[model samples]
Target chain A: MTKGTLYLIPVPLAEGAEHVSYTPFQLELIDHIKEYIVENEKTARKFLKAAGLKTPQQELRIHDYGKHVRDKVNYQELLAGALRGEDIGLMSEAGCPGVADPGAEVVFEAHKRGIKVVPLIGPSSILLALMASGFSGQNFSFIGYLPIDKGARSKKIKDLEQESQREKRTQLFIETPFRNNQLLSELLKSCKPQTRLCIACNLTAPDEYIRTQTIEKWRSETVDLHKKPCIFLLYAG
Target chain B: MTKGTLYLIPVPLAEGAEHVSYTPFQLELIDHIKEYIVENEKTARKFLKAAGLKTPQQELRIHDYGKHVRDKVNYQELLAGALRGEDIGLMSEAGCPGVADPGAEVVFEAHKRGIKVVPLIGPSSILLALMASGFSGQNFSFIGYLPIDKGARSKKIKDLEQESQREKRTQLFIETPFRNNQLLSELLKSCKPQTRLCIACNLTAPDEYIRTQTIEKWRSETVDLHKKPCIFLLYAG
Candidate 1:
């Protein structure tokens, strides 16, 4: 039997938003996969069920490897089934895997073993936010999450601003849901007043809000994003 | 009537590969959109027809842009239908719009007019290639296209390598289809032997090939990518 391919699956950015966020083709593809490496099995099972997976959840072989799964895992073991001609999928809890998520290791392994890797189209908050922000689409960088410490985070934001100015590159980063407001406050205080900031909140959801404004304008407005997942993008150029 | 939203639509990377590259939702969305701001009206109609558009090609209101169609388009005029409760879709000739495409102008205008912008998930050769590359996803930059001049291009490659080494960021860029092999040859000769490069060719198609190797390893191989669209990624970290 030929070695099976590994599929990089993209999931919805938020719960209950799949209908609008995912294409029917993505859903159909999700249903056919028998083995999956996901950020969370519980969340993955829910997504698969919503996507119309026919197999019983108990019967499906799932390897969870995100924050919750603490046990040391052999990355090669996850792809063992694929090597034996059983196609497998790598999924993240939200958005596309291997993108600010944990599916990269599996994809890296697939490359090493010469196994074909197919990336399916689905909701990716980063790309979606960038598409909507109207920022510099030609040159941009995704810096993942920001530093947790206050001083470091502030310094990093300034550095990113400097880089954006120098390279004319848009800088993108995310913050924890609850710290959404704090990050915004930090950005408003740290970045230059003229630096443009795009706040994409609860993307692809009913409450989706994406706005790009100068830091000065954002500072003047009374805003409250208590616990919504948000992506912050700043451009000094 | 409520103001219609702006949809950032994704198109196939290449011709005749829509079935596998686009999701059913994307196709359905295309069928429903009456007005489209595309890279080219001719190509947009062809794509719509292939995606099962029910409207007659002549009846579809398409405003062509890109390298041709010299009239300076009034972006607000293109979106006037959306203000009148008619949903408008911004589409590129290939891949996701607003990214290395001409769709960002409309998205920027949408924000100014307070019109909702909905980004539908679909194939993005850049993201797909990065997902498959196993590079530093934590920090990565998309530089779009490099300089065409020999000296400038070489200098830019060196600068990118230096940035990648210092920041541990993955650098991504694309080339004109016919110049794929030329870019590869230049990269092999200009970049350090140990610098890793991943060439993603004909992404999301039957002949898709994504391979990563040291610059030295690629130097000895025979490659011919005559006119295939490709994404090139490199990292020194």
Candidate 2:
């Protein structure tokens, strides 16, 4: 018997942004997938509904892979349905699955089982930010998050800045939303004066803001990024 | 007076893949924007027509930034429409604008002129390949292309494998379509047996192929990748 394919679906970066985040084809694909492995069941069901899932919410089979259950879940058991010829959809809490999320483990498991993996197109904040950053997209790095330790974070920032200058590559990283302001101040203090910095906040939202400016110019201005989803890009070259 | 926003648009990576690559909101936005700065005039016009552009092709203003004219083009003049309060769209030959394309220069010019930059949702091969590669997405780098010289390319591949093992970061890069098979052979020869490699070709197309395996296993298989657009990802961890 042939194994069913695994579809990696993407959720919107922000709430209520589905209209611009999903394509008609994605909605049609999801309509045929009744089983899913999602980061969070509640949000995933809500998203599936938004994406026009025709199946009743309760009738659809969902295996939660959220933070609380991630460690205890069996990777192979997740693909058992696919092995039984049932197409399974994989989704994260936000953005694309398998990137900056625990979904990669499931995808890896699918590969081990010889199942086909198909990735659909959707809104990815990291990709969107890089597109609007005005940086060297030819060579870029997305380092998920910096160290939480103050000293280590500072050192990482400086290292990224130096590498950016030496290689002429764009360095991208994100910070926790509540600590956004703190990270912003730290970035300004840690990077060189002439390094170009681009702060993209609330991507794909009504209040989206994206701008690139030199560290020197940013230091002279004041902006609050507290509790805002943002992607910070640095390019010293 | 408020300057017009610079909309960075993305074209489907493969021909006739727009149905799955673009959202309805993107089509609506393009319908209203009659001016565009594109890498190739012929392809861009064809893409716009496929994307549901209502404006007559002859009535639209297009600034060609194709390879031959890229060096001679004055970027400031490309944004003349936006400067005069008309929204301008920026597109590349394929995939997202301002990424691995000459569109970055135009975006940078827009930032310098204080024009707002908005990125629309679409398919990005690099992002999609990472999503399905079952590799580390937490920390990844797109180094664009490796050195062309035989010795230099070999050394670079070894260095990337080492870096991937040390940092647990996925290394993504591409080769000229015709050189894909050559690069594949070089990678199998330069890396350790356990290092994982994923080759994603003709992404988002009917013939799309994505798979991951260790170097040892890949050496035992035979495949042809000549003249096919592809992305190579490495993960030694």
The most accurate candidate by lDDT is 2
**Residue runs of model 2 more than 4 Å from their true location after superposition:** none
Model 2 docking tier (incorrect/acceptable/medium/high): high
lDDT of all predictions: 0.84, 0.92
Instruction: Please give, for residues B1-237, the per-residue lDDT of candidate 1 as tens digits.
Output: 799988988888766666556655576777788898888878888788888898778777887766665357786788898998888898987888888777776787788787889887777888888888878777889999899889999999999999899988889999988888889898998999998898888887779898877899899899888798889999898
Model 1 chain B scores worst on lDDT over the 10 consecutive residues at B16-25
Question: How does residue B157 of candidate 2 score in lDDT?
Answer: 95
Docking class of 1: medium
Per-residue lDDT of model 2, residues A112-199, tens digit only: 8899999999988889999999999999999988999999999999999999999999999999899999999999999889999999
lDDT of 2 by residue, B19-91 (tens): 8999988999998998999888999999998888898999999998888988888867888899899999999
Clashing pairs in 2: none
Tell me the DockQ of each model, to 2 decimals. 0.62, 0.87
Q: Give residue A143's lDDT in candidate 1 (0 to 100).
A: 91
